[model samples]
Target: MNKKIRFSDINMMNDYQEERWGYRVFELAVTNILNDELLQKKFPSLNEAFFQKVDEIIAPLQLLLYPVISCFSKDPDVLSQWRAYADDGRGFALGFNGVALNSMPVTLLEVEYDQKIQIEEMKTALLAAHIRNLESGNDFGSQFRTDCQLIGAWKVGFKNSAFREEKEVRSLHMLDVCVDGDRPRLVDAGGEALGKEVNGEQVGYRVQDGAIIAYVDIPIPHLDNAPLIQEVWVGPKNINGIGNIVYFMSECGLKDYAIHQSKASYR
Candidate 1:
């Protein structure tokens, strides 16, 4: 099907939100990494610069791999995962994640947050960025205008109801243990640890406030989850650009997408 993948608007988005809406958890992390100070002035706070980087990555991929979340609750605990996800006062133009995008329902049913979300059982890392060296960009969360910045997944449990407001909110756990990345460190997780692997033999991590951060010697991984916006998902008008992106990505030897698929077998 030739579908139009779009960054939605207020009116149309309200419709999606009322139904089922989703956001790419990695998108926020990629945005922060793109604006890294180490990259010098390559990334500016300006919309053009930011989006250009975003489009560069998206222009090349197969959109089918990109997933989003829909039917999210307005509960404060849920919103705390990425506080800046909404509220302009936070920082950056995050309208895309909020009102703009829609999730692929087929993919979403597999990772439903309410299906007994916990630390060990959660093997998939929604988003992970490495903090190589002390100055590594783990602080990207702080730069992005969010109070809660941690390397963890949103542990969710919910109760459904006919009435939206009457629905029960059970839990949202931003679970993470801080380690010292200054030495050899291994966060014993099968797939939930999405960030790039460290190269140093001795490093450590520590959880301060509510975030998990580390300092290491390896080249920190920028963002972990598979990105949204692929050529397969794009409209016909942009096929040519997407084609070129695919070609370039192949020629440049970009890393192939190797994300963990959900094991949930639903009826």
Candidate 2:
């Protein structure tokens, strides 16, 4: 007989609490890097260094749908949906150290100043912190990488045609995470066999602590119609570690309407 599982039986709070410890440390590092008085004084209005660092760290993960922004709809439903996506097991938290940085504020700030000096400074600082943390044996990013390798791979994109049209018209963006050296491969949620394709050339990356880091920008236009992404299977070769690979996928929606409203009010 199969036993029933209840939400009470699951320790969701404990899970989040445990993850928050590492997230807090990372956050502190990011804050220090971005808010450095010297850095700010040099850049004047925006922090370009900080934004650069953020991009370096996140760019590899291929999760962000758009550049960081601030303006966001106050709609509770929208916020709730975002929260659910972030909390979902197949969300960004599982990988990248369980630190889910909301794109709303970042995107707003970026567009406000066209990702000026301040944003670049912030990105640089964040990337520095991430590298430092990794080299210093923090293991947060490393752990997340390991988790991602185990979970395999998955894909994410929009569903409704209207959403896709709006996004394309407004230049909607998405990211893809490819592991296991450089060979291009695709798999479904059920671990079923799909197809493979060879890209131009494979760039070599160092595998540290059984984790490899690489970056690529693959535009997935097909995903615009189907936004529902549950899980993914990373290729076998990408699964470097002994245990399972943790897969995480996320899509960022640019609130063009919100930005338009903000501009209109200011005008």
Candidate 3:
């Protein structure tokens, strides 16, 4: 059967259950061991052919979309925190060790910030770096050089600026477990009800692409900080080695989304 594992954020969720989930679409796909036959029957393409029931590509059952943030290594401290997280998967104790950093290889590159930006506004400039990376491609920033997934992005920056750096990730919130017993009910990334709650009837949104769009503004303590109005697609870096079962958003796919959104809003 052509089963579409639709996200609760954009579907009827006809036979779903009542509960919260903490994982991304890619993660869930690996967890469920998505059925390859069904997936190919669903989303067939040249790109779709490359994905097999393997380490990175499983059976293609994941059905949620997340943002991919671009990371800019501009400061020593920022790089250090990222290294710590990447090396030990202990991101300031933020439940962010989704990938086993020690087992996999890492490549770090550093690019300079414009001296014209001024040191005082360095924080703001950094935020801009992330936004620019996501909205546009970062020709001036460091490269991740690997396919990774973004898991948790809820963090504080500035002195801990590395937390704000854009990274790849592999999961999101939906039913980590089958809630309805027969079929799993997917919810928003935050686990909010996808549709309006009612005893006999219900009301909700079904626009898949109309999922929630958030813009976070974190203020930093500094002098040269520019007025940052960031609309970046922030996601976690999906490193290698934590589990052979992990999957994540492709960098190219995310860039397409970011570029489309930027043109609609800014261009």
- What is the per-residue lDDT of model 3 for residues 1-267, given as tens digits with 9 covering 90 to 100? 111111222122211210112122223333232344553354333122222212231122233332211123322223334445344322211221112211111111232222222222332322333344444453333321112122111110111122334332222222222246776543322221213221211212334355542221111112122212112322124223322211222321211121001111110
- Score every model by TM-score: 0.19, 0.20, 0.17
Q: What digit string (tens of lDDT, one per residue) describes model 1 on residues 157-266?
A: 21222223423221111112234665422332211113323222223445555555432221212232533222221211222354564575456444342212112121
How does model 2 score by TM-score?
Answer: 0.20
Task: Rank candidates by TM-score, best first.
Answer: 2, 1, 3
Q: How many clashing pairs per prediction, in order?
A: 28, 52, 21
Q: What would you estimate as the lDDT of candidate 1? A: 0.28
Measured with C-alpha atoms, the lDDT of residue 1 in candidate 3 is: 15
Candidate 1 ranges beyond 4 A from true positions: 1-109, 113-154, 157-232, 236-243, 254-267
lDDT of each: 0.28, 0.28, 0.25
Q: Model 2, range 168-260, lDDT digits (tens) per residue?
A: 111112122244487553211111111333232222234445655332222122222332222222221232331222221212331111110
The Cα RMSD of model 2 versus the native structure comes to 20.9
Candidate 2: deviation at residue 113, Å? 3.6
